[model samples]
Target: MMSKIISENKVAQVAKLIDKAKNIVIVCHIAPDGDAIGSSLGMYHFLNALDKMTTVVIPDAMPDNLLFLKGTKEILNYSKYPEFAGELIEKADLIFCLDFNALKRLGEKMEVAIASSKARKVMVDHHLDPEGFCDVTISHPEISSTSELVFRLICRMGMFDLFETDSATAIYTGMMTDTGNFTYNSNKSDMYFIIEELIKKGIDKDEIYTKVFNTNTVDKIRLNGYAVSEKLEVFPKHKAAMITLTREELNRYHYRKGDSEGLVNVPLGIENIVFSAFFREEKDFIKVSLRSRGSFPANKVASEHFNGGGHLNAAGGEFYGTMEEIKERFVKILPLYNQYL
Candidate 1:
């Protein structure tokens, strides 16, 4: 039997909230990753089983690689249709903020809209330091992903019988993506039991892995190659590696949203390279993805240097700074964590 990490009181409270809700809107973090999309759509499908009028809203576009899921086409992008997304929030009696603790993670404009909405909000996230915004916050940083929480929450609320294949597929995708396909933060025995349950629901794990990881385009392959061969920098002394890709360089390769999904983890494969960071240039900010192996705390580097917090080995942050400044700051900060060396 799996251990109960979530309190029964919170589960009962969430169940009561779900019982009283009719219209529901689900939102996730900006640049929605697999866990965000998986958890959101998983809950979307689950609520539909109960005949709730549900809508899934995203702050911006996700990588097209995730489009193979059951209901990607049905999700609304707030970046493209601000008014309509706001309308959904306005009409929603309850909103499920999945995979994000702070409303600001939905991007600036969508954050303001959701914060101003009359709908009661519940946050289901596996990130650190949740903000005090949601009425019911189900934040568990130790969990593998928010998708796992979604599964646990449903079973805890006595609705596991309603779960089906579609939800299983999405929830599995979230867990797979968040934990780097169970390579990190997934040593717990109970996690395997959840996977067994998902498999019983008819999710083809191999196919999902192939689709999510192996199905890359020619440009994506070339872009990744160029990023590694040309832009990758290794610090043997620090046992670290860094990759920086600018907007111009990305445009040169016909970049798409998901082109660099696993690029951050590539460095860890190098011998003795325990820490890695990827800096992708965005219009307004630098997108930071950090990864590490063994006892190295990548999240501490992210939290202290970039104002972001997540799991020890995997975390992300955004910085509003120039490329030169980011590089200098990273170099300056590396010595502070040299104790890990």
Candidate 2:
């Protein structure tokens, strides 16, 4: 569904900006996934190729799973580099935001840096219509991943050959993860073409898959089992399922930060389930992930009830209450879903 309107000029405009800037910084949404990390790193590499002084700053801590990326170690943690990163952002000639539609998603730490930046801010993302928060915006909801947009930007500049193995691996991994391992939202033709390009770069696809999916530790496996067996709750008549995990359970199972990435999708494989939700207790609030099947629009549900939105089939929100309150909210809203079903 990507249109020809996203012309070479648009790509070149961003490239020319990067090529001309003195100091550049990259930022992604908090709780970054592969797309966020990959796009940021890929852009960082491209800018660094032009000898621009660039740094990737994340508002929160980087997940351990993503440390394998080429420049992951260079990602400045907000806690440690807040003042310095803010100073650099304030003085930057340009700033690039990747994978997120809004500045609020960068969280509180980097919010001021973003707001006060004298630099022109450019957004590259694959979400729905944005909030118009940037000087220049390139958004395409139909794209499978922001990493693909990163690849396109580089290729349009005729600098695709400058992509190193680590950069390619990161971008390819993001493409794979965001598309549900190439099974979701990816038309067969485009998926194959992208995979072919990545393969031609000599990326070890099998090894990357193993690292992302099969490299879980024993403790992580146990945590997954505990989450699935103990937390999963189904409302057969309502065709809904919910999985709730508390910090206590996480502690008992030795769960680290990113250990619960794909647990919410488990119940979606079940027949007759119209919607699925996952609730995890974080330090301050409860995180929610919502999924819909068939005709259900989970994004609507999230935005209306849970204060969040994403793709139609998958979305997320956060609540500042106990699990009981969250469950009550969902139960009260079940009748609304009947119309969709």
Candidate 3:
């Protein structure tokens, strides 16, 4: 049985809205991750199956690794085609905001357009402190992923029988990726039950795993090796590990969007290392990814210092500065989190 995380009244209201709406647009956050893409595409496929005019909009370019998912080619990028995305939002009867907590996470232009739209918005996300922007907010930070919440919501609406193979694939991808292939934030038994149901829907778990994880390019592999062998720094006193990469170094490797996907979690393999941080230099800011084991508050570090927040074990934030400056700042902040270590 699905958990009662979403109230029955809210489910009924959402179902009524879905049934009444003719044109539906599903949207996700900026720099879409697997959970964001998976939940959006999963809803797109499901809504299309219901004979609704469905559209999926993304704020920016998605990682190339996610291109293999069904219906991804049909997704409209706001950064690439703002006019069309704006038109869709304007004409949408009901908008389903998936995988993000705030409208700002949709980027400036998209957020403005969405905020100005008359469409009734429903948010389905697993994030902390959701802003009161949507008509119906289905925010549950304790949930594993937005994709899993999507699955539970579908089942709660008595639509499990209508779930198709492609939709199942999308949902499974989100659940798998968000949990790091069932490595963390996946201790619940219901997660496995949902996997069993998706498997019954004809999704090969092993193939999905291979497609997402084992499809790395040679350049990405080389980059990982170099980052680990040379760039990785371990601070044993703080039980932390960090890896910082510059734009020049990335350009040398012909770095792709998802090249550094799992690089943040590598240093946790060390015996006493409970915390890991990966900093990658972007065009104007340094992207931060944090991961920790046990009861360490990775999210606290991200939120208090780096202007970001997420789960306790896995969180991310960004720093606007040079690579050296960000690394120095991180080192300086280590003493504050000494209790967590």
What's the lDDT for residue 54 in model 2?
95
Best by lDDT: 3
Model with the higher TM-score, candidate 1 or 3: 3
lDDT of each: 0.91, 0.83, 0.92
Residue-by-residue lDDT tens digits, candidate 2, 197-297: 87887788888777778878788899989888888889887899999888898898888878888888888878998799999898988998988876788
lDDT, candidate 3, 183-262, per-residue tens: 98889988898899999999988888888888889999999999999999999999999998999999999998989999
For candidate 2, give the lDDT. 0.83
lDDT (Cα, tens digit) per residue for candidate 1, span 230-298: 999998888999999999999999999899889999999999999999999999999999999878898
The number of the candidate with the highest TM-score is 3
State the number of backbone clashes in model 2.
Answer: 0
Candidate 2, RMSD to the unseen true structure:
1.9
Per-residue error for 287 in candidate 2, Å, reads 0.6
